[model samples]
Target: MEYLVLALKGGCMGVADIIPGVSGGTMAFITGIYDQLIDAVRSFDFEFIKKLFKLDLIGAFEGPHLRFLLPLLFGLVLAMVSVANLMHYLLGTHPVEVWALFFGLIAASIIVVGRRIGEASVSNVLIGIAGAVFSYLLVGMIPVTTPDQLWFVFLCATISICAMILPGISGAFILLLLGKYEYITGALRNPADPGNAAILLAFVGGCIVGVSLFSRVLHYFLERHHSATVSLLTGFMAGAMRKVWPWKEVLDTVTIRGKVHVLSEANVLPPAYDSSFMLALALAGAGFSGVIFLEWLSSANRG
Candidate 1:
């Protein structure tokens, strides 16, 4: 039952990962597996590699939290491969509704993370404000043109993958900011090509290097400064609300690989109350309610 639950949570993470302004880490947080996820990632360290080098198969196997990680990975990859296209279609066709749902989800996440803070110190508040402000500015920045070289792709993946594990920050959006979203996606579309395969190999290699290092840093801070860390993450989610707002005015766009990608956009108020507005509102409510239910379920599972 627990494994099944983990898989379902991973599926949710997988779904979130595909969206531009959403993060898989937020889903992990929502599902109450964020700490475990970090630990699992951190397990693949020097000790684990040493076991493999010595051909101590059992020791290598026992070093990492495979029981928890495997099922979760299964669900995450399954969702990414199986549902990615549908999600893209939805974002392209029913963007307003999709963004509305995610907006509610992120908003509720902020409340949940904020409550995790042990004390309401002035320092925590200030740190949270900094996080919020930084995130706000980050998500609102324009995408730029960047080189498509394999080395650059490796670097982008290394940096962007950090966001994949950081609650509230979007890895996909990070790639967009680095101007490699289309390049990577285009490679994904033609992965069989030699050049594409090489690009992907470099990208995956970078991700491995990234998590091996970043996970330790995150785990360390999470253990030593739980309150302050949660405060910042909460603020990050709060600031990300600007990116997920249901209504936006696209300022510039460019077509890449025959798809229109937004270069810049500004949030805007919905037009005079109407049926569309009501629909967005209702969907947002559903998303908010959904998170509340998930949190309740997660607590129950822990109990």
Candidate 2:
């Protein structure tokens, strides 16, 4: 029953990860498993390797808290398998509603994370502002033509996976910046593509390397500089709002692998007081309310 519960939490994280502006780490934090998840991942270190060298396979696995990790990972994989296509469809067909929901989610996240930072120092505030500015600029950049080469594909995974584990940053959004979101998500959706198998394998490898290296750095900062780290992450969530803004004008489109992609988009305001516009506002409100509800639920659970 405990393992099942953990897997359920993992599934929730996976769903968050599937969305471009949402973070699996945020899901973990909301679900009250963020620290445990980080510790489990961080445990894959020299001690575990020593156990492996000593030929204590069970010890090696168990030493790294795999007992807690396996079920959670299984749940995450299950969710990605189940919901990838559904997310793709919604993003394609109901983009406004989807982006509106994401906008609300991020807006709420900024508030939540800011509160978590507790005290506001001048240095911390400045640091946070810097983070937000960096992310805002990063997300606003135009997607360029990227190479189809396997190595660059691997590098994309390496970079995005780092963001994926952070509380506010979205791995999928990072991949979008690198021009690999569609390709990777498409590969996951259609596993039979001959080239996809290799790409997916390489991606998995990159994830492992990326997560292993990056998790330790995050763990150190989180432990040693909790408030500053939280502030920076809060800023990141604030900056990411630009990517998920509900209204955008597509300046140009590019076809990649025979699929149309938005090559450039400029944010725009919706028409005033129209029915469609009102509906979008309602959806954004619902999304905002949803995050508040989650925060309440989390608090109640803690109590």
Candidate 3:
């Protein structure tokens, strides 16, 4: 039953990963599994490798927190594979409502994460502001044109995977900024092809390397600088609010692999008070309330 619940949380993270501005790490944080997640990643240490090298397969299997990670991974993969079409359709058809919900979600997340800092100090506040400024500038940067070479693709994965594990940073958005979102998604469509297979394999290798190294750094800071780390993360989510705002005036677009991609866009205010505005406001409220409910549920579980 516990594993089932963990998988359910993983599925939510998977769905979040499909959205451009949403982070799977945000889902994990909201679902109260963020600390466990970091630990799970850190569990793959020298002991596990030593067991593998000694051909003690069972020992290796037991070496890490596989029992916890396996179910979450299964659900994450299942949702990403299964719900991609449905999410794409919804984003295309009901863009406003969708973004509004996520905007509300992240807004609430900022509060939740902030509350954990207890009382704030001057240095922490400055750190938070700096983080917000960095993320705001980051999300607003224009996408650059880049090569389709294998090494560059590997580099993109290694870098973006770090962003993916961050609560406020969307790995997908990172890919977009790196000019590889379309390229990678296109390869996913025909993964059985030789070229696509190689690309996917390279991406997987990069992710493994990236996550192994990055998780340790994150764990060290989080364990030692809990309040400051969380404060910066809260600031990151707060700044990302600009990206998920429901209204946007698209400035430019380009076609890639026969698909139209938004190359530039600006967030805008809704034109007027009307039925559309009311619906968006209502959805935002619901999304906000959903997080509060999840927090309550998480507290109950802990109690």
Candidate 4:
């Protein structure tokens, strides 16, 4: 039962991580495991390394705070692998509704995270605005090509992983912007291919280097300036809600390797003087309210 619960939560988080605008970190925050996850990552240390090199599994696991980490990671990994297929299916069939829920979730997250900033100081407000505008503009930019060189892969991994840990940004989306998403996701989907293997290996190497470095920075910020950091993250998330809005019109669909790829444009539904607009408004309202409910649950748990 315990394992099942963990797996279910992890699966939900994995689904969030797979999506372009959704954040696994946000899901972790909503679910009340964000701090624990950070602590586990922070526990990786020299003693843990020494035990691993010695092939002392028991010592290695115990030296780091593996008790918190192992189960959580088991959950996360299982969810990631499982949800990859599930998301592929859902996004194929119900893209709008799926995005709608995420849109609502992120909108709610902005409020939840924003309230954590105790004071609306001039600097903090400016910082918050800067964070929002920067992310908002950053999200709209086109993808850039990167040399598929191993060193570049390592750098990409470092940067992408940092974004992955942040509450608002999506690592996969970052890869998409970096022109590596297709390469990496392709590798995962077809590991037997040599090209795919190379891409996957490079990406994995990049993620390791990135995570190790960024974790320290994140740990410092969280410990020393929790409110300010959270406020900025909240602002980033608020701006990011633009990317997740549910209504999109399909611009084109292309068949690649016997699979369909959709290209879409954001659309606003016409405000009719009648019932369709009412229905959409209701759906949007329901979506927004659902997030508030989740926030309420989260606060209740914290209290």
Q: Please give, for residues 1-303, the per-residue lDDT of candidate 2 as tens digits.
A: 989989998998888788877888877766678789889889999888798999999888876887799999999988987899999999889888888877877787777778888778998999899989988887777766678778988899999999888877889878887888877887888676788888888888899889989999999999999999989988887888888898889999988778887867889997466887777788888877877887888789789
lDDT score, candidate 2? 0.84
Give each model a TM-score. 0.94, 0.91, 0.94, 0.82
| Candidate 3 per-residue C-alpha lDDT over 87-191 given as tens digits, one digit per residue, 9 for 90 to 100 | 778889999999989988888888777888765998789888988888888889888779998898889999988888898888888988998876786676567
Output candidate 3 Cα RMSD: 1.7
Give Cα distance to truth, residue 262, candidate 2, Å: 1.6
Best candidate, lDDT: 1
TM-score of 2: 0.91
Give the distance in Å from residue 108's predicted Cα in candidate 4 to where it truly belongs.
0.9
How close to the true structure is residue 218 of candidate 3, measured as C-alpha lDDT? 96
For residue 134, model 1's alpha carbon misses the true position, in angstroms, by 0.4
- In terms of lDDT, model 3 sits at 0.85
Off by over 4 Å in 4: 1-3, 147-154, 190-201, 249-290
lDDT of each: 0.87, 0.84, 0.85, 0.71
Better of 2 and 3 by TM-score: 3
lDDT rank order? 1, 3, 2, 4
Residue-level lDDT of model 4, residues 1-303, one tens digit each, is 655655555666677767877778877776667776677676777787788999998878875666555666677766665667677777778666677668777777777777778878887787788788877776665555667676777677778877877788877778767766665655666677887777667777787677766787888888898777887888778767767776666566566457554544455655353565455456666766876787797788669
